[model samples]
Target: MAAFNFTPSDTSLFILMGIPGLEAAHIWISIPFFTFYIISLLGNFTVVFVVGKEQSLHKPMYLLICMLALTDIGMSTSIVPKALFIFWFNLKGITVNGCLAQMFFLYAIAIMHSAILVTMAFDRYVAICSPLRYTTILTNARIAKLGLVGLTRAVFFILPEPLFLSRLPFCANQIIPHTYCDHIVVAKMSCGDITVSRLYGLVIAVIVIGFDLTLIGLSYGLIIRAVLRISSKKANLKALKTCTAHICVMLTAYTPILFSILTHRFGQGITPHIHIILANLCFIVPPMLNPIIYGVKTKELRDKVGKCRRSSLAATDFKPA
Candidate 1:
């Protein structure tokens, strides 16, 4: 296939507003983004360190939490740093190959995150509904295999998106409307008809997000039924408490995504701002709030983090001169 000679457009439609230009807005935006990035990094790293350091947390639920933290870090690192550089430094230009690569990794990690969350729901379901079988079913080998399956799903499902993007003829509009090279944004830049690309996007959305959400709902539904059957009030309360963190994380991850899709599909361009905001929220908000949710809802993690902090402080105080 022949390569398309694409000329970038001058208009910045979805570019950041409320500023003189990309450079100025980027500089201001970088301040908060950089801070959030640092916090997210520390928050996730703390979870990993605490889990890894303590043998007590080697169980299935904590293992799932560790995996979630890893995915959250991967998802955030894939996009935010590059976006900040492009917007702040006035380096808006990206080659076709470069744009496709960015989109591929971003979407892949995002899908992986969703898949892992679904697996976690299953983890919780088994732990609550079949406590005796939980250990036998969710062993270390099984958890590792589930992770590999999620990674494979992410890689295979996202392959068509970048491949389809590379085939499109990007005529005069090489400039993507958003900060990063998102799938829909890049598809809109194509001069050729994007019917196939749009269809693929919808299909993948259904398979990844739709299927995952459906399974999660089923898992929770079963869990709720099991909880109701428990005659003891203390047992029911404990089960509900155990699920609170996971439920909050799931809501945070899925709600914005659904809103983004609905706003884009039905609201048209009338609410592009809402779409943009929700898209970023879909990416950043979950990672940022996940650690906090776990900390507040799960006392074990909170105590571990507190202990880690105190140990670090004590080590600092006794440093060699």
Candidate 2:
């Protein structure tokens, strides 16, 4: 833990501060984070449970939703537990290997979420614009292949970080300013020149988030045009309605991410805690809100959720005290 530490030893560690300048309020801030975790877990789990139990819910669209729910869970699980442990247990020091592991999962899962949203947009595009070809185009086998491709792509982009990071010389201080491990944040802590790391991260943001957003925008544009081409007003409305929840989820998922990235490189006037909070929100908000948005917008999911709830109630052993 000395200046210009050239290599990580068996005991080299990086300390994660829950939130700098607000140490006294760490526990207080953690309350809402904890709430988000619970709601996100239960809400996403319910989505999966309802979809699994109801045979009618077994479709390409619903299965994709289930994939999305699991991705949300992975995104949250990557950071929340360690963050909470830092807040509640004061266990801030993480080993080099541990920090690398966190960084890998955090980045990979977040990028995976973006990839899945893009897939969902494509699914809707096929279903709405080319209804007759939807099944043939997005078959069960094809979807599985797409899932594998997404998983592999995410890992490929993220695997380089820790590899190069392990070789970078660290400054005297090994403390990270936020709740979780971040690629750029950790890279900045290196005493060595980090030009390569910065550019690599920029390339990733461009290809993953920027490119995915472009695809999503184009898909929706075509979807809108296809809907307008429908002569029946009822059919047009139905098709558009099917996309509303997806649009909301996409906004929730990507808006904070874009804001954080833009602010990171250019927003010099922004406060550190504000940037960190927004970065955390990129993971927290969507997981907790995706199911709620979908359930509210889609009557089918809403009804199935209700039915599952009623069934659970009926099966409960309630008795007079």
Q: Which candidate is the best by TM-score?
A: 2
- Provide the lowest-lDDT 10-residue window in model 2: 1-10
Model 1 reaches what TM-score against the true structure? 0.89
Instruction: State each model's CA lDDT, in order.
Output: 0.79, 0.87
lDDT of 1 at 225: 99
Candidate 1: which stretches are off by over 4 Å? Answer: 1-24, 269-271, 319-321
Each candidate's TM vs. the true structure? 0.89, 0.93
- Which candidate number has the best lDDT? 2
Give a tens-digit lDDT track for model 1, residues 80-186.
Answer: 78667654665555566777887898889899889889988999999899999988999988998999999999999999998987787765545455666788878
| Candidate 2: stretches off by over 4 Å | 1-11, 317-321
Pairs with backbone N, CA or C atoms under 3 Å apart (clashes), candidate 1: none
Q: Tell me how far the alpha carbon of residue 32 in candidate 2 is from the true structure, in angstroms, after superposition.
A: 0.6
Per-residue lDDT value at 272 in model 1: 54
Task: Name the lDDT of candidate 1.
Answer: 0.79
Candidate 2 local lDDT, 1-321, one digit each (tens):
222232344238888887898889889988999999999999999999998999998878888888899999999999998888877878787877889999898888888888888889999999998889988999867877888888999999998888888889887677889998888889988889888887987898788877898999999999989988889999988889899999999889888887887898799998898888888888998999998998899799899999988888987956668
| Per-prediction backbone clash count | 0, 0
